[model samples]
Target: MNQYPDPHQGEPWQQPSGGNPGWGLPPEPHTGGQLEPYGNPTGGYQPAGMGGMPEPTEPTLDTIGDIAITQNTVITPSGRFPIRGTVWTTTDMSRTEQSTPVWAIIVAILFIWTCLLSLLFLLVKDTKTTGHIQVTVQGGGHYHATQIMVSNSAYVQHVQQQVNYARSLAA
Candidate 1:
């Protein structure tokens, strides 16, 4: 003995006749669901309000000056005066173990002996020296000074002090 009535036949809410299955209400009208295009749809996707990316602007002399001082370099452009700063000094050195030229080595190996050539190579030394300096200006620019003689550590310290002074002047 079945205690529950058959679902298809006994429930008034469950109508065998075609009708609303939920809440006994007529179905909502079919409305096409598509988002409205933002900005120019033909132009492709963009933020809802903004038209497009802002245009790039040219850099001014003040901007260029700031960059020059920050990068420690001078900027020279056509129809504009070159900007520079006070000079400082540094050094570059190179040492070579094998001082003899290739031809000398070949001739020595061929005529004299490899042992004598090796001895000559050991006796001679090759050294090169180069120097640079630092130049800095107040709110204008800073750069390493070039074409200067080898500077002692004292001179370098002085230049660094000057650079610090110039940098402190910037607002």
Candidate 2:
């Protein structure tokens, strides 16, 4: 076999004129495992360190201050309407074990609702006939004879107090 350096090419050790620095060796094929040209030498995959996974981002407490508790109410000539009363807390997965009094209050509400339903059922089934009353107030008796059914005034007064208290708080 004869290996000769042509005059047009130069000595075998020297590079040829107008030839690419890395001649047609199929410009290194890209691999997921290996770094690519014009790409991060560490590849796109980020390990725990060295720009691998992003540092766990934390929400700023300043942004936390944006959270607000709102209570809304509306009053008409007849009665007051409590629109919204809620408590909201900002938290993440780390607060799984946290407790709020809202749940207890909700349970108490459910229990009271159950008791009220039972009382209503009793009122419906009891032999005591329900009679309507139309008592006229002295000066501000603007509303004409409204049918007020006599069925356990105790619970009615209790609910009215709750609604009034809620109205007061909103005011």
Best by TM-score: 1
Best by lDDT: 1
Q: lDDT per model, in order?
A: 0.39, 0.35
Instruction: Tell me the spans in candidate 1 whose CA falls farther than 4 Å from its real position.
Output: 1-100, 114-118, 130-132, 137-171
Tens digits of per-residue lDDT for model 1 on 81-153?
Answer: 1233343233333222335456655555675554554445434444433354434232234233323233454
Q: Determine the C-alpha RMSD for candidate 2 after optimal superposition of all C-alphas.
A: 27.3
State in Å the error of residue 113, model 1.
3.5
In candidate 2, residue 36 scores what lDDT?
51
CA lDDT for candidate 2: 0.35
Total backbone collisions for each predicted model: 7, 2
Find the number of clashing residue pairs for candidate 1.
7
